[model samples]
Target: MKILHTSDWHLGRIFNQQSLLDDQAYILQEIIQQAVNHQVSAVIVAGDIYDRALPPADAVALLDRTLNTLIGEHNIPVIMISGNHDGAQRLGFGSSLLKHSGLHLFTSFDQLLEPVILSEAEGSDLVIWGIPYCDPEHVNQYYKVKTTDHQSAQEHVTQLLHEHIARHYPHSATHVVISHSFIAGASVSDSERSLSIGGAECVSADLFKDFHYTALGHLHQAQHRSYSHVRYSGSPLKYSFSEVNHNKGVSIVSFHADQSCNIEHVPLEPKRNVRIIEGELADLLAQGKKDPNNHDYVQVKLTNKEALLDPMASLREVYPNILDLVKVRNNEGSTNSERSRAQLARSEMDIINDFYHAMNNEHLTDEQRQILQNVLTELNNTDTERSSKRA
Candidate 1:
């Protein structure tokens, strides 16, 4: 049995205040195409199906269309769970009714023992257990078990699943665990929110050892943890500038009749990619003119020490989707803050003169300088008298 694993869709995500519905819609179409091309038995969406708990109308529409095409049109079964960003109750709305259409949503704790059985001519061959993003308090109240942190919560939850499986289906078969979590040792990028402060949120990869394949979410980078079968499919598109180099994709997992598994990564290309470009403003403009995909979202780093008129406005003329602009000075690549620190070392008069010129495009006249000096001397004398009185 073959299943395509993908997650972290983050529908309704806005990057730099621009909507990503078009980009998301484009990638989801490709994913559907891949599903058809690969002929996978089911599609597994680990979690983070929405960018926020309350999503916009268009985002909800996009999700509806995508699911309709996958489940209604193609007759593909989708196993989805809710992530930290999702409102579990909202996402799982109409889930029981939707299951008739082959959409299995596991959003609450009571559904942990339930399994989505992938059957063959003889009987069930694969048993999938989904553990959604849940709080320790909710788990404690549901199972009457105490869990202090995220790791402890996840450990206890998986332990119950193990016991339930052992008791009910002791037969030989391929068991799959689908969850949304931050597994220890998985590389993290800026886009993912820390589940907790310190290291309390991270769960050990050893917890999923008994399963044939563990499809995980939470991390926005496609990778495996501890073993090849345990994996994260990553977000379909780059959500932050830090993810410029991420090779975003989905994992196609195949489960054999013998209970063995094979995992393959199939890349998903976005309509417009996120990237960073560095150079002087003039050179970047020159380069942008020659580039065809200059429309890609970019963060510009200008190497010019000298000031320019509206660098962001200028860059937007060529690369219309510039994410942000940063100014760097000198051969050593000092930042804008470093330049300000250097200005801090200058005399007050010098700093004022520079600020005056920057604002008015003219330096202080000799008469203006003399007037400023007299005012400074008067202020110094007044400060001296006040300090004497205080002493």
Candidate 2:
């Protein structure tokens, strides 16, 4: 069976405060097209289907239409779950009705022990275990124990999952575990929230020892874990500047009765290209390489002494995605004394160097000279104290 693994679509996400509904619609259409072309049996959306629990009206409409296009038009089954950013009760609303339309949403841990089984006439079977984002309060209630950290929560859930698999599949059938959490060794993007601090929420890699394959989400970078069978499908689009260099895409996974799977990455087309360009304003204006024709989001760094007049307005005339601009101040100390003083104070060596520069190069008042001497004396005393302690 072929399954498309995609997550963190983050529908209704905004880029620099601009709505990404149009970009999301375009990517969603392409995803359906890929599903049809590849003849995939199922599409598994791991988590964070919406940017927020309460998505915007347009986001709601867009998701509704996209789901219809995939299931009704293409006749593919979809399995989705809610993440930390999603409200389980809200996403689970009308889920019973949507199931009749071939959409399976596992939004809460209340049904964590349940497995959604799909089988075909060829004697091949798939026992998919869907574990949604667990709220500590909910998991503690279900397990009858107070799970304080993510590690404990994961332990509780994994134990329950193993029991469920053993009870239902008899330890002989092929199974896949789908979950949304931060697994160890996975790269995190700025778009996602940290679920744990100091390894509190992290689970061991050996937790999925019984499963044929593990499909994960939460981290926006698609990658394989220590086990080849465990993988993350990552986010479908670049939601933040931290992910500007990542290739946004989906993974098409094919499963066989032999318990082997093949994974393929299908790229998504961006509505507007994201590019970072750095140079002096005069050079950028003269080069005229910031194509005005295409709608591309751009970050331009002005590597000049000062910023030009209305730099954004001028750049927007040539590049639509000039969402951010930064003026790179030259290294030469500013003529302004306050600016120089603040910069010099940032570094220990620079403080001493600035003092000496003032002493030898610039004329200074007796009061200013005495202040610099006092600062140097404090530094010398601190160094002497450290040396004495070491000795």
Candidate 3:
């Protein structure tokens, strides 16, 4: 059976306070097209369907339309769950109606026991065990946990799921587990929402040793965990500057009865690109002109002699998504000038003078100190003259 694994859609997400709905819509369209081209039996969205507990009206409309295209137009079954950023009750609405359309939405801990089972005439049955964003307290209440640690939470949930799976089907049936949590050895980007207060909430990949395949989510970078069978599909779009170079896409997995799987990455085409360019503004503009790539969302590291005035305004000339402009203040003639700028930024006038004096102190520069004194005296004279004129 063919199953395409994808997650962390983070619909309604914003980058640097700019709405990413357009990019997100484009990514989802790409996913649908890939599903059609591959003729996958099921499209599994591991979790994090939305960026917030209650998505906006536009986000809701977008999700609704996308699901229609997937289920109505493409005729593909979709199995999805809620993540830390989603509210279970909110996404769970109309889930009953959606199931009839071959879209299974597991949005709460109460439904973890119910695995969505699908089968084909060729005698292959695939069971998808959907575990939404598991909370220690909620899981304890649902499964009656004896402990609250990360391992205990996983053990409690997995044990219940195992018991159910074992009772329903034998080890012969193809099984896939879906979850939204951090796993050990998976790289996390800054844009992903944390599940707990500390990193201890993440479970080790060994917990899923029994499953044939695990489609995971929550991390924004596509990566394999401690187990090759366990993997994260990552987000569809670059949600942060840290993920400027990430190949945002989806994963397609083909399952066989022998418990072997083949995974492939399907590239996504986003509306805008996120890029980081490091050099002077002139050099960056020159490079952009020379290159064939589009400079949509860009972060420039300016290795310039001086800080540009209104760097954002200057970068907007070439790239619209100029989120950051890092100035590398340097020049052979302006070493002291750069230090002065740093000191002034910190409002440290005495420290600035002390540093200047110390730098020249060892050189026996009496002439330099006199020059500095004369400059300071002129500054004081100007202040006194301005104050008297104002009085």
| lDDT, each prediction | 0.88, 0.78, 0.81
Stretches of candidate 1 off by over 4 Å are 122-124, 331-338, 341-391
Instruction: lDDT for model 3, please.
Output: 0.81
lDDT of 3 by residue, 86-187 (tens): 888989988878788899988877677778887877756888889888878777777665566666787788888888887878776888999888886678
On lDDT, the stronger of 2 and 3 is: 3
TM-score for all predictions? 0.86, 0.82, 0.84
Quick one: best TM-score, which candidate? 1
Positional deviation of residue 114's Cα in model 2 after best superposition, in angstroms = 2.7
**Candidate 2 clashing pairs, residues 3+ apart or interchain:** 297-321, 298-321
Clashes of each: 0, 2, 0
Output the lDDT of residue 145, model 1.
84
- The digit string of per-residue lDDT tens for model 1 on 50-74 reads 9999999999999999989999999
Best by lDDT: 1
Among all windows of 10 consecutive residues in model 2, the one with the lowest summed lDDT is: 354-363
